[model samples]
Target chain A: MTVQDIGFGTASAQPLPAQKGPVTAARQRRTWTIYAAMCVAGLLPTLLGASASLQAAGIGLWLPGAGFLSVGGWAAVLFPLTLALFVFSLVAWFWAGMVLGPVIVWLGSAALAGAMAGDTVWAGGPYAAAFATAGIGYAFHRRNVRLRDAALAKIAPRVAFLDASLAEVRAQAAEIPDPATREMTPTDLAALRYLLDRALQPVTEWGGFDIIDQFQPAALRYQLNHMGFALGIAQTAYVPNFHGYMGQAQRNLIDKYLLRKVWGYWVYESCWGHLNFTNWDPAARDNIMLTGWFGMHVGQYMLASGDRRYLEPGSLTFRLNAKTAYVHDFNTIIGSVKTNYDSAEFGLFACEPNWIYPICNHYGLASLAVQDAVTGSDNVRRYAPGWFKMLNQEFTDEAGSIIGLRSQHTGMPIPFPTGEVAYAAFQNCFAPGSAQQQWAIARREIAPAIHPDANGKMRISLPGKGLDTGNYKSGHTGSFASILVAAKEFGDAYVAEAAQNSLDSDCGLEIRDGVRRYTGGSNDTNTYAILGQLMQAGDFRRSFTQGPHAPSRTGPVLEAASYPAVLVAQAISDGDNLRLVLYPGAGEGTQTLGLERLQPGRAYTVTGATTDAVTASPDGRAGLDVMLCGRTAVTVTPA
Target chain B: MACCAFAVYLLSQLLWPLRWLRDRLLVAPAVTASASVAWSPASVAAPVARKWRWKPALLLLLAAEVFGLGVAATAASVSAPAQPSVEFLDALHGSICSAVKGSLS
Candidate 1:
């Protein structure tokens, strides 16, 4: 069978094939069912009217103080307040994947009910038990922290001595590949298919996205941003001049980001976390999580495609409602990052209220770098030194690893999984020296984990049962994907290959209808895996710092082509001539191809098509009909 | 017993608005107040009055409370129990008492 017959040539217009196994969905359904059962069990005592204290305790299990609904007095008002608290706790749990939220709500409400009913046995007993459990949990957590710190201390000196030069890294990244001949491998095409399947769908439709949680990393917003990042890299490295489907995919992600379901959580976060109830504008204040990542996404699109549409005033407007909209474009979004950076004492602003994460700040800094590249501004030079200074001083641990998180209000550090590996690729955009140093340390640490799999293929086997933060499940897809990204950025082929292998063999790699995704991972990790696959050496840094190759700007481009029928694997131009490597996406047949940006009124020789020659229209456009059998190659040059 | 239960229920409803006023008037000032000895009664009272305009808010709070209590009383009278469900009322009373106790503790 031909490669096209094995689902490699599926069209972008068709809906993504149904997922083979909805594991996360099944798990979620089971969890919700258990929670519902618990609530139902809690209802029995209340319905029986066994005793006031018993009923109160029961109500606490369902919705705290719901018994007040039966009190038949002004006290009934308290029921709504308690119910609101319960709902807020659920939101918090989903928002951050913090199990403690629901636990606290359940136990605290139960204790409160008992106290209100003057039943020491029910309320006081559970409250004390909760405290004891917490105390034990805290003790175990501290012990783990101590062990982790001691281990890091041993590696501190080695990391400190690792040599990395910013100039060398920059010089290496400055070498751009030729735009005349660029093609994607079959693996790259499969990964691209995964992105297209989601991006080609309606912006409102969320068919392929992970909806396991709405928290920072696991949220749908993150999936959209990461998908955009992957597509941006693809556009820069492979098809620099082709802006057909890839451009649409990137724009759809940006447009989907403007949805309220994606970003409205910031409103609640603003009210309770920041104590600011007057305005709920997401981009107005200190949500670098949204503003920073989104800036890079939108800026990279403009830089790569030379599509300045998003740069238009109010072009990237986020409408909260019919009347209230935070109207912003590329400039204003980057402006928010600058404003926050200038004022922030920590040099890195907060993501969720009171929590400042250096990993997120890496995105914030990279966004500035991309903005500088796009607008010819000196944002990185102006702000990065101070930013790095604060980061080193306040946010670095004894081992020189960037601390995962710190409280913006209090100076307390919180342990998170954002180690050097997670920060390396993003940090490489602006601070290559520090990024390389991080990768060096991370490589040394991760080396021991890379061993031959059952089939003797090198694969990463991370220690312990790693957590996929996207779904709050026990999996290492995210960890493996992260290492793959870092390895690709630092030009460590061995580690990158091993990480990819691990994702392929262990992470349930599924390719259906030409789209490849690691089904074991969430939408976020799968996107990262795709990004790692798309990058060649310095692609990440170059996409942010220098953008697409210069010839891609004023070159002949393959503009119009039907999907599934004509899969343009490689479309590049060196100013005058257009070269395209096409595959029969649907089957072997004759297909029409539209070309644009040619020299007006120039006669061009076109090979591997039905017609041998064609003349450019006055508008610098031409059409060619090509016989697409297996791997059809087409080239149009001035005769 | 019924009268006492009714009184406790009324007091429980009052607690929420009282807590709101305490947060705005009492807790906010203490949190924001400077440790200077040159504090004046008029200076403090003027800002408090100007910033919150508590008079209208208090009036609104009281209005809502009255309206809620009327609705609650009407609902209770209409759904009056044959056996005089004083056990539920007593439980609610105990809840208010326990809340007060817990706060004080």
Candidate 2:
């Protein structure tokens, strides 16, 4: 099927309308206001005919170097350079979130300007201002940390109260059968529709994704990888044998990822961030963020659909230009992970240059696990033991929470929101026991936040202003999505339902044109939410490790169908028989579907279709007409 | 004034190659459905990867530096009677304005 014909309708084929989202817009406005104020402050010195030293000092405040206009001659060159530096610093600040670098550069340039003008006062004035700004920034950071610590201290007692009740909740969750076996509900189909709407569009089109800062989670790469993940999980759990447009949708995401626009940022990041100008290949060094996440994404596709195309040499080549590209395949990509893990002093490598994030390392570990399952290798066994040891010894805090981030250079922890709750689901793929314990602790800690809403349904209420790291915005949608993922992974239905309720009620849940999304959340959070919605008990672990069931591998499969007309909720097989539950995605209508892998020259008894029996063609393909209204079930078995 | 000019000139010289590299690397071929393949090593036309040539840029930078130093020396000789700080600041101001004007043009 063509890209437009795969999803619900032409609207679904188009990219989702670009939205800055309220939180991101507010943050952008605040940043612009700050810059504007700085400009006004700089203009004051120039307007007042201040001393050369004061005007030079104003250079640090004003990005446009308005103060430098008075300091004529070759010094005029500084104006252009100053403007360039300001723009560069702003970009660096946004990309890396490091305020100190910009602070140093701005003040340093001011001081240099003063020194060059033979003004001793100008040289010292900017330095003093820089010191004051730094001290104030640090104070605010520490105060926020203290307030957070105090808040968590208050919740410490309630954690014990909830810990006692978790055992029975978990025991009850154990009895729930695999949710994938049942037919997908309308809500589930809608959630899957959100993914399909984005994935089915042209690779160049970025609809329905947050395009804020490119350095972190908001980058297109992270969004693409996560979408692949959700789709791979849906494939493994729901429609393993079906590889018509579904498989193509997954491949399209991978294709988009290979585009230079999606990943070209790494080259600049490598040059400046890592200070490595020679080799800009993203997969070569310490970017576990790219290699690890991408590895798991590609490996999951292989495992779920049994596609070995990526395993071919140079299959995943990252073309830098007409002349230069980083040629890699599944094995080479995994080889990079192994090399990084082998050489890493912290036993976990970094995402950016010097920042080590345990959550990202968990992705790396899961990648290893998936690679092992896909290739029948022993990478998880070879690496996980030491990886866990380094994680515990170096990365664990006193409260037994995984430290969100640490400086590989300084060996100091930076407070990020990644705790047990965020790590549990990914960690489950490689280390289920540790993952279970993490979920147990996370459930207890988050228990204080779980309370009844006005409708008496349980929901999560995170303390303080919620932060979505994806967009660097303020929201609780990401927190709820993470909790939902963990809760579903370990069969904690009580919390899963509660977290889902929070996402639905609190995070602006919207369904339009048969697609579901949380308008309040970022693309990353929405993807995570979809992943949580599709998952059931053991689904996360099974998708990454064990993959689809053996019987589902070789069976009569639904090969082609009209999209938005025939929605395949469940297209699974039992070695010989193909079972499909179709829903009318656009509206109720009759649709033709093609089936493959059927036993040739055999008459098949088809139920819930227009024809009662149809013989397979000589090529093992057959056409059947089915009328879809509500949930219509069709079974094709040899007669 | 001369020192400020020299510093700005040197900084630009140092940053030019990086900017050149960035622009070159960011240039990517547009992908379409017909051009897209599952996996093919043959798709990437292997050309001899060229190393960045710093000699030409460096030569231009060196020539500019010599020209700037000669002009500074000549200006110093002509304005030798003025107070050193006043002369320096005035020259600095003049050079900065000219540099700014040159950039805008």
Best by TM-score: 2
lDDT of 2 by residue, A89-137 (tens): 6556445634355565566555445444433223343444445446655
Q: Provide the overall lDDT of each model, using Cα atoms, as 2-decimal numbers.
A: 0.70, 0.72
Q: Per-residue lDDT tens digits of candidate 1, residues A1-639?
A: 211211111111122232111322343356557657766766666556566556556655654544443333444445555555556665564354233555655665454443345321232333333344456559968986795566455443452334343233344445545545568876688677777767877888766665644556778889888999999988888887777777888999999999888988787777766667778887878888999999999999988888889889999888889999888898999999999998987778988876788888989999999999999999999999888767755665544556687656535566677887888898889977667656766777787888998888998887787877765556788898888888888777788889999888887776666666776776677788889988877789888888777877788888888755666678777778887888775678888888888999999998989999999999999898999987778889899
- Per-residue lDDT of candidate 2, residues B36-93 (tens digit): 1111122243221121245597688779866865554444334322467767676766
Q: Predict model 1's lDDT versus the native.
A: 0.70
How many backbone collisions does model 1 have? 2
* TM-score of every candidate relative to the true structure: 0.70, 0.71
In candidate 1, which residue ranges exceed 4 Å CA deviation? A1-148, A156-180, B1-105
Evaluate residue A462 in candidate 2 and report its C-alpha lDDT on the 0 to 100 scale.
82
DockQ-based CAPRI category assigned to the predicted complex of candidate 1: incorrect
Q: How accurate is chain B of model 1, given as a TM-score from 0 to 1?
A: 0.41
Candidate with best DockQ: 2
When superposed on Cα atoms, how far off is each prediction in RMSD? 18.6, 14.2
Looking at model 1 chain A, report the run of 10 residues with the lowest lDDT sum: A3-12
